[model samples]
Target: MCGIVGLFIKNPELESELGRHVSAMLLEMSERGPDSAGAAVYRNEVDSGRIKLTLFSSQAQPDWSAFDRQLRDFDAQSTVKPHLNHAVVETSKSLQQMQTWLQSHAEVRINSSGKKIEIYKEKGSPASFIDSFKVADYTGTHALGHTRMATESAVTTEHSHPFSTGDDLCLVHNGSLSNHNRLRENLRSRGISFQTDNDSEVAAGYLNWRLQEGDGLDDALHHAVEDLDGFYTFAIGTREGFAVLRDPIGCKPAIIAETDDWAAMSSEYRAIAQLPGAAKAKIWEPEPAKIYSWQRQ
Candidate 1:
């Protein structure tokens, strides 16, 4: 079991508190999945020509300055912002180029890569994880949070939800992907890689694959409904906004609500209730195989 929450801020005034809202939603959904939690915040944007990579250091203590120096060696103009175990590195180099050089540094892993997305995860309760990352103070255009029960994969921090396989794109899923093994191999052949045996990663990889093939978010999700064999509900976050989709069987629970200021999706209504405009938001359960998305102009 797992709980997924997403928020897209429509009003610029609410952008500064994006993470506060997401934190409440995530904590509210913790009853469904309290063991591990993660959040992908779309903020701290780099220049359009550059990219931001959130890196996680597995070492007990890492020298962020040395890491920054390595990045600057790759791109003299690169910069870094260090958090606890994670740091956001910005550079003009292509992702492939960065990943190629990082192949040698096994302890530092790329958590998420984009101009505006920063991801943080911990193998603890939602409340503790949020506090550790100071998620409530994060500001962003949109955010995706996930609390996981980890039925399939190990309950490790790296195996947590909100997996990102593409730039400025991340996915939080709340159900099992039945054919993930086969799908994983297929994606690997197509040049997509997996860091864990988690099926949710496969789902994220599939969407990234579709996107790389020239499909937009809506089109990629439509393809997902047909090609992905599972009973799942997914909330996907991109640089522009977020999307929600349920599988054909729709066995998993999902609720969507939208108001004048924001749109939110969660595994249950209680989580949505944590939002400011929930009392008057237009709420509904997403239809089977239907793709619902919101984006900024």
Candidate 2:
């Protein structure tokens, strides 16, 4: 099993509290997952043309200067900020070109990239890493987090959840997909590459492939329910909005709470109860095969 938490703030006043709220929610569900933890934070975009790439290196002390120089070789200007085991690089190059250049390197892996999204994840406990990373200090419009128990994959950072396959689009899944091996082969044949063997990564790739075909978030999720064979719950976050969907059988646990200020969802009510106005929020379990989406205005 895994723990999933998402928060979308509608009130401008609550924007700065996005990370704090999400951090609390994630810690609340720490017992559900002890293998790895991750989070995708979406903040206001200061540079429309630049993309923020969150990268991971197996080395505790990575050669960030060399990586920045490599980006410059591609005619892209960049700024690198190193965290504990990950780094966030903001570059002016197009996403396609940037990805191509990064793919050639063996040591670095791109976690997520977009104008507003910055992803941070590692192979460790959520409660321990959350404070060290100062996750509560981040400010964003929306955010999603995952704590993985590692049912099908190894307990490595690469196998962590909140997988990102496109710009500003990330997915965190609970439960397993039985047909993921078959689906992975199909996606690979379509020219879609996967970084990890994790089933959750396949889910992200499937959504990215659908979105590339001109499907909107809602439409893509509708197709996902029909195409992907699994007993799962998905909490996806994009630049435009946040969405939640459950399999037709509804085997995985999910709860949603919505107040005038924010919309929050988690594996259990205790996670959402930590929110500012959760006491007065309308809370319920999402129905099976139904799409619940909230977009930013």
Candidate 3:
């Protein structure tokens, strides 16, 4: 089991408080999942000509300057902002080009990449992850947070949730998939590579593949409902907005709440209760197999 939380600030004036709100929401779900935690944040700082990638180094003390230099050769305008073991990189290179360039450099692991996305995660309790990452200090439009219990995989940081496979796209799952092995093979044959054995990564890859094939967010999720065999609830994050989905059976828990200032979804309503004005927010459990989304116009 796991816990997932998402908050999208509807009022731009409250964007600066997004991280604080999400941190509170995450802390509320700490009991549901105590193994690890992660968050994907979207900001408007990135321009269309460039992409932001979150790179993680396994080294005790990564040479961020040298890492920046390596990227400089690929995209001279590249900039790396280091935070502990992970660094957020902004580069002018095309997605495919930067991806190919990173292929030869296996020392660095790419988390999430998008024009407006940065992902941070680690193996620890929610409170620990938040404190070490300075999660509460971040300001963004929207964010997705996950606390993983790790029933199926090793409790390493690499096995954390909020996995990403495409630019500005990420997913956090609260349930399991039965056909991931077969699906993973099929997706690999179709050229979608994966870095882990986690079933959730395959789900993220499946959605990314559909999006790459021209499917919109809703369509991609609907396709996921049909093509993927799973009992799961997913919160997906993108540059445009965020989306929530549940399998037809609805075996897992999920609640969505929206107020004038923000919209949020979590494994339980208690998480949503942490938001401001949540007392008057429209609150309800997500229906089975339904796609619920909120985007900034």
Give residue 132's lDDT in candidate 3 (0 to 100).
95
TM-score of each: 0.97, 0.96, 0.97
Better of 1 and 2 by TM-score: 1
- Candidate 2 vs candidate 3: the lDDT winner is 3
Per-residue alpha-carbon lDDT of model 2 for 37-59, expressed as tens digits? 99999986848678888888888
Candidate 1 lDDT, 1-297, residue by residue in tens: 889999999999999999889989999888888889999999878877898898998886788999888878879988888988888888888888999989988999999998889889978899999898999998989999999988888898789978995889999999998899999999999998889899999999999999999998899998888889988999998889988899998899999999999988999999999999799999999998898899999
Residue 84, candidate 1: C-alpha displacement in angstroms: 1.1
Tell me how many clashing residue pairs each candidate has: 0, 0, 0
Query: Candidate 3 residues 1-297, lDDT tens each?
Result: 899999999999999999899999999999989999999999866876888889887776888998888778877898999998899998888777877898877778899888888999999899999999999988989999999988767887788988995888899999999999999999999999888888998999999899889998889999999998978999999887899999999999999999889999999999998999999999999999999999989
Candidate 1 local distance difference test against the native: 0.90
Native-to-model Cα distance after best TM-score fit, residue 48 in candidate 2, in Å? 2.6
- Model 2 residue 107 CA deviation in Å: 0.7
lDDT of each: 0.90, 0.89, 0.91
Model 3 spans with C-alpha error above 4 angstroms: none
TM-score of 3: 0.97
TM-score, cand. 1: 0.97
| Positional deviation of residue 98's Cα in model 2 after best superposition, in angstroms | 1.3
